[model samples]
Structure formats: structure tokens, C-alpha cells
Target: MSRFVRQSYYRHVYGQPSKREMCFDNIKVSASAWDTNLAAANPKFLSVNYQASGGGAFLVVPLTHTGKLPDLYPLCRAHTAPVLDTSFSPFSDTLIASSGEDGKIVLTHIDEDRLTAALRLEKPEVNDLEPVLRLSGHVRKAGHVKWHPVAENVLASTSLEVKIWDVEKAACVVELPQQPDMVGSMSFNWTGTLLATTCKDKKLRIYDLRSGELTSMADSHTGIKGSRVEWMGRLDRICTTGFSKFSDRQVFVWNSGDISKGPIKQLTIDTSSGTLMPFWSDNDILFLAGKGDGNVRYYEYEADELHYLTEYKSSEPQRGMCWLPRRALNTQDCEIARAYKVTNNLVEPISFIVPRKSDSFQADIYPPALSGKPALSSSDFFAGKTAEPILVSLDNLSETAAPPIKSSLYASTPVVPGSGAVSPALPPSEPPAPRSISRAPSPVSTKHDPLPSSSPAIEQPPVSHQPPPSSIVAPSVDAHPEQRSSSSSADVDQLTKENQELKDELAEKDCVIRNLELQLEKFKTNQMKIIELSKNSLN
Candidate 1:
């Protein structure tokens, strides 16, 4: 009754699930994603952390489906700390990158030839795994790694700093450093040009390669443990998950057009203890989020708001989880989304299928269909050239059916004319809104009629601390120092006004800080009350 298996799978990722009857049979593994930084699954293989007593191993298990690992056990071992995260390259079926406590980024090549041979031997087998390339740069544990969704030979990692690497050249091309705050999570926009990151300092920062570092930032969260970001496909909007001033888990939607204005949409997910990991489906129309628990909630993205669809419940709580690529899903079964959930000692597959009998192809999850080829240049990478990424549309819905948000960045055309390299998008409509935060002129413009019908020019995002792109000439302080006389009267007035504004800002911040401290104390008191109640019941 359940159909799910196709494509060449090179690895086995740990997942947990429960089904009606005979839908899925899970396999157990000694090495799991428990208390580890990562577990990932793509079309061909799976990567998970495998820790031994003396050292640590990053296992690349073949998804042989025989319910057993081939003779090649525990793939490879070489990390000083429990492996933090692993990512399979979107461009190559054989390449995977792993990072961890040792501050090492290892690119390992999977021996597909040997794996194919082992399958014919009548018993499962694994070949000796080794790193094909190693690049080290992070001073602290590299907590996460993500390959550019539409680019080849490119990867990004986060720890105390965010580094964009060109695997072909084995060099870090751009690095965004953070002090006094560690990055909790990072997600790239549909075009792979911008990255949204949530940090321990309770702020969300968006970084762009063209602009050297930290292009945008906003104060966010309060629990101070973890926060995460997910870019809504193709649109200029981004969704983030973090804590409130009282430590309650909340998810917020931001208009990157002017991040300083604050979140445009916010929701309180739950009071659960585990951090919430949110995933936006390739279709760009649905969102699924799972917390530290077994329940996974799905939502419909419509009219700039998230509408709850349903929740997937598992018998056991998952330690970690991952979603498979859209191309690899059983489209025939109306399967909209699939997740590999890692639990106690097993990884199971769970499918979110829609009920239908006509067997019609679902075009709503359709934008990812365009990313069939590698978009990055290997020669440019080897030459130490920081090439701009080729942007592709990942919008699964048609503009006629679903439209772009009121204040969203509207782009439906391709980056290269005749190439059809568009980021899936809903066509533009209406004018832009006044900035949510007042400061520099908004970098993205709405004044220009949507991108030309033929030529595609994606202006790079400006790097923080650097002069913004030359296109938007920002007014200089001395441009009109004195409109009245040669005395610079306007300049002196401007300074006096600026000083007053600064005083006002400081006073406002002080008041906000006092309010947050009070809330923290209040939460602590409630926690104490709950503890006392538990103690009395024990007595």
C-alpha cells in the first residue's frame, strides 16, 4: 500500500517513524545522531555521527535497504570532537562534507564502484572511506554545514564564524566572524546568494557573499540557547525560530527588505523543551517543523501567513531528523514530503502523502524541477575567483494561483536569459512598503520595473562595514555640510540632532532591558513554584 524507493541511494541516514501497517520497517544502528550536531540524507547517501570511546567517526552508510550495513563497517573515523554536522554535495553523488569539534572540514568521496560490487557478493559490504579533501578554518566546533542549493563545489559552515568554501580550490573565499555570540543555525535563500543566521546573542543576521560579511542584523530571542532560520523560497521574506523574553519558543517572519523594522509575523509554537527545527518544502507552499519531541507539524504557506495543515506523531521522541530531496520522493503516491527521523537506535522513513485517486502530478511542489544541473564554475573556483551564484527559481506554485507577499521581493525570471535559470517565484504586484526600520536606503528596489524580460542582473548584497554597492548612492555626511552659508550651519545642527537621537535611543534601550530583566525574574519565580509543587507531591 506504500511505495517509496527509487534512485541510487549511497548512504543510510538514521530516521524514526510509525505507520498504519506494513508501511515502513525501520533499521537499528549502534551509531546514531543522538546528542550529536548532525544527521543528513540526500538522494544517494546518508551521513551521521559515529562516536567510539577513543575517537569519533563520521559514518557514510550506503542505503542498501537490506536492513544491514555491508562488510565495510563504521565508514570513516577522524574527528577530535563528536562530529557536529555532515552534508552531501548537491552536485555530486559521491562527495560529502563533514565538520565537527576538531574544526576540520573533510570532503570524502564514496566508492560507488566498490559499493556496487559488494551488493553482488550476497552480503552487504562497505568500502574503506577516506577524505578526498580537507579544509580547516573554524577555531571552534563547526556546528553546521550546508551546500549551496543551486551551486556546485561550494559549501558553507558555521561556528564562531561563517565560512563560504570553494571545494574545487580547497579554500575559504569568504568568512563572517561573530564575537561573544555563537551561531545556532543558518539557512540560505532560494538563490544561494544570501544566508540568514540566528545567533546566541539573540539576534538574526543575514550575510551575503558579495558584501564581505554581516550585511544585516536584528535583535532576536531571549532563552539564549538556540535559534534557527529558514528562508521562504524565492521571496525576500525569511522565517526564524527563537525564544521570547520569558523563554517561550516562538517563530517569526521577517521582511529582509528592511530587517531592522522587526518581524512582520510571529507565532508561539509551544512550551516544549527541545529546540524547533523548521523546514520549508521545495514546493515553497508548505512548511514542516519538528521540535525536540516526536511530533512534526506541517503548515500551509498562504497569504503571507502560516496555516496549520497537520502533525505527524511518532511513538518515540526523535533525537534528530532530515528531509529527502523532492526529486527522490515518490511523486506517484502524492507524497508531498518525506523525513528520515532518528530515534533511540533506529532510523525510520515517514511520508506525508495527500489522498487522491486521479494520480495527477502535483505541480505545486514544482519549482525545484529547474535545478537539474550544477550552477557553479570549477575553473573560476580553482582560479580563486569568487563567482556569483546562478540563481534558480524554487517556487512550486504558479503566480496565477498563489501570489507573492505584499512587501516581498518579487522575482520570477531567470538570472541568465534563454537559460531559464529563475528562482521559483510569484510575479511582482503593487509597490514596496516604507521601511520597517529607518536607516540606510533599502538595498533591494521596487521602483525598477520587475527584472528586464531578457537580461538578468542580480545585484550583490552589500557587506556590512563596507561601502554599499555603488548603484544606490547613499547621501554622504559632508555632501551638503552647509546649505545656509560656508559656516556649515546645517552640519552643526545635524550633529546636535544626532546626539539627541542617540540619548533617546539609549534611554529606550535601558527601559527595554529593565523590562526583560523583570520578565526573567518572573519566569524564575514561576519555575520555583512548579518545583515546590513537584516536591510536595513527592513527599
Candidate 2:
């Protein structure tokens, strides 16, 4: 019989299990801009709209490894009006495009290092970064700009009308005339063969890019005007949102295969006061919707379940939010997620940290006699001798054995099963016949002593088996010698250098302070002497 030591029981209770934890960091950008837009290059770099002062500016900040933001790069400074929308080129990492209220769309290639140094310098020192191409054709503010997903040089801008431009040729490729109201949002399918636009007239229209013809048009929201339209990840599905005060603010997911038909899934929002800002993830498995109530809700498409995973509250209403893509960081592929908010005078962007499991540790050893114990099998360990022992019978073993039952060993009295039950026992069955009895021999007869029985009779034992206690050794916690030596040596050297530098600085300050004190004392002495001379002259 094997016995478990008390130390093992305590180890099971106090040991730290593997856990997943997450932390969040925020970055503030562009001072006091009410109308702003944001975009990112795989979360490593971000571009935000600085829509104050005369025209507006674009601030590009680097997401540092320590979760802090470095200085911003001011890109695309030629617009004479507030930038309405900005987007990073999906085809190229270095390219960025922006549209302004000045009715112009500008494309620029950013030099990240030079921009970072310029923003760190003092004000009035302007950087020479300029846009590569600037197109001006729209009569009103270009409310939205989107890059063609498949084509490299193809771009689209929407305002009063939707216009497609070939950036390399510096000319408009095609133009689609709009209805009475302005076009609010525009997006292209993954293949760039189809384009979808949402108009203020509460209509969602899809166009065939090859022929430049109106393929299909559907009335998305009856009472509310359409605000945005997004093509759900390479699929034939598209999502659109509406903006209205009295009407219900809702999102409609439609199948692009037949655009004239109504939406398949209509997600409704509370018509209180908040606006729904929807962002689709790359996998299309999840999409996040932010509301004016300051909650970020996540919805899975397949399960049709909306999980309120996380939320951040703001005193002011939310403006907009978007997700960054996955990229390589220090040779490892990682996804960096971020959300941008424009609330009151603050422009804040929040990022999330992915939780990871703890590092591996040494495994505990068990004795050979008890090596067949099951690890983490509470039923096998807790059940008494009455219960079947399948694990021990099968000889299954693991490094960390399950905890044994201690109550059975320490309890003085055992509780019998079905003990205090009422009623009487059933009638006993008939007994079996007795075997034939052998004749007893005369006492002290030396001739033939009856041979002693070969097998001895053993009585049944109790359920609890108390085994001897074994010495329990705790795991070592000391650091390795190499690690300790290197840490101490580095710390000593750093402290010595820092101490010398501090002493030099302090000595210099002390000299300056002593000089000032000496000057004050001399001035006081001169004043006292003059007072004495004046008194003598007066006498």
C-alpha cells in the first residue's frame, strides 16, 4: 500500500497553474480634432487625421516595441481643407492615400525615418515630404477614398459622384454619376471586379468595374440614410449601415450574387442615440461593432452569436474604429490589433495584448511502487477501497500523480452505506449442506500427527490502508550560477558609471551655487561697512 505525504496535498492546493493574461496600451494623436480618420500598416505604423488649423495634417506614428508611441511623421500637408478620409494602400506597404474637403485625392510614398526625425525636431521646421500624385475633379468634399484591392494603380474616390483614377497615368479612368445626395461610402470586392457604394439617398448600388455599368441597386434602409458599405472578406456578402435620428440604425448583410434582393441578415441597433461602427476581420469569422454607448461588441458570422468580449467607455461619443492586420515581428508572425476613437477633444487609439501560456517547468517524480497512479484523476484518487480501481489495475502512470484521499486514513469511524434505512430485511435464502467431518485422533499420539494444512486462512481487512510516510523534498528555487553572475556584474558596472556621472554633475552645480553665495556675502559686508562710515560722518 502506498501513502501520500502531507506536503503533496499542500502542493496541489498552492501550485500555480498556467494562465493567459492581457494588457492594453493607448496612444494620443492630433490635438483637438473633431473630424478625423485613421488607418494602419499592419499595426507597426499608423496614420491619423489632424483636422484642425487652416487645412489639416496627417500624423504617422510608430508603434514601439515597449507598447509606447514614438514621435509622429507629418505626411500629406498640401490639402487646404480638413482631410475627410485616409487609407493605407493595400497593395503596397509604403504607399498611403488621403482625400480632403478641398475636393482632392492625394497619393504619397512615406519615408518613415526622415518623417520620424522631423516630428521630433522643434516647430516651424517643416519636412519636405510631398505627395506623388494629386487628382482634383470632385466639386464637393471627397468624403471617402478606397484603394482597389486587386489592381495596383487603380483607386476610387466618392463625393457627389464616384470616380476611378489610374495613379500612374495621373488621369481619371472612369466616373459614375451619383443621384441627388452625396455618396457616403465606397468599397471594392476582393477581386476588384465589382464596386459597392452607399449614397445618402438610402440606396446601395453595385457596379461592374469592367464595363462601368450599373449592375444592381437595392434600397438598403427605408427610413434611415446609408452611411457606410463594406465588402465582407472576398466572399459574395456585403455589409452596410444607416444613419438617421428617428429611424432605426441597423446593419444589413446582403449577398452580392443578387444585389436587387434584400439583405439576408438584418442586425438592429438600439435607436437611442449611438451609432454603429462595424469592422470586419480578415478571416471574416468575427467583426466588431462599436456604439456610442462606449461598448465594443463582437459578432461571429457562423455561430450568429454576439459576444460582449471587451469594452472601453468614453465621456464623449465614438467617432470611428478599425483593425490592423497580422505581420512579422522579430521573426515571429503576430497580430497587432488597434481601435481609434475621437471623443470630444481627445484623439485616442487603443491596442490589445495577446495572452500567452507560462513557460515550462520541471516535472515531479513519483516512487516506483506508486508510479501507476493516474495524474489529475480525481475520481480514482478520491474513491475508497469499495470503489473499483481501474487505473491501478491497468498500470497507468504519469509524472504528477493525482492527490490521494486523506479523510479515510484520519477518520476514526467509517460510515456504513445504507445505514439508517427503515423497513425490515427480506427473508434469508436456504443454506447449503455441510461437508463430511473427519474423526478426531487421540491427543499426544506420536505415530501419525495430522499433516498441517498447506494454506492458512486470511481474514478480510478494512477499506482504509495506511501506508508508511515517505520523505517529501521540495523543488529547488535557486537561480543558476551563470545567470546570477552575469546579472550582478552588469548591475555593478552600470551603478559605477552612473554614480561617477552623477558626482561630476553635482560638483559642477555645487561650484556655481558657492559662487552665488560668496557674492551675496560680499554684498552684505559692503553694505554694513557703508552704514558704519555713514554713522561716523554724521557724528
Best model per lDDT: 1
Residues 1-539, candidate 2, lDDT per residue (tens digit)? Answer: 65963332112111111111121123333443222234444435566665344465565655432232332223456577877778876545566778878888876666667666654655312343455455677888887788665345567888888877655444465677666788867777644557888776878899865446788998877655356787765456777777544667777777777768687677676574444666765323334444445555544343222223334444446555555542221111111234555443343444432232323211221111112111212111111111111121112332332233223321123222221112232232221221111311111111222222331211111112222233222455756867766766776676667766765674465445434644775698899999999999999
TM-score of each: 0.65, 0.55
Candidate 1 stretches with Cα past 4 Å from truth are 1-37, 64-74, 116-127, 364-372, 378-539
10 residues in a row with least lDDT, candidate 1: 455-464
- Tens-place lDDT digits, model 1, residues 457-515: 11111111222254333466665545424544555566667766765674465445434
Worst lDDT run of 10 residues, candidate 2, spans: 9-18
Candidate 2: stretches off by over 4 Å:
1-43, 65-75, 119-124, 243-246, 303-317, 328-337, 344-539
Backbone clash total for model 2 is 0
The candidate scoring highest on TM-score is 1
Supply candidate 2's per-residue lDDT for 494. Answer: 69
lDDT of 1 at 329: 68
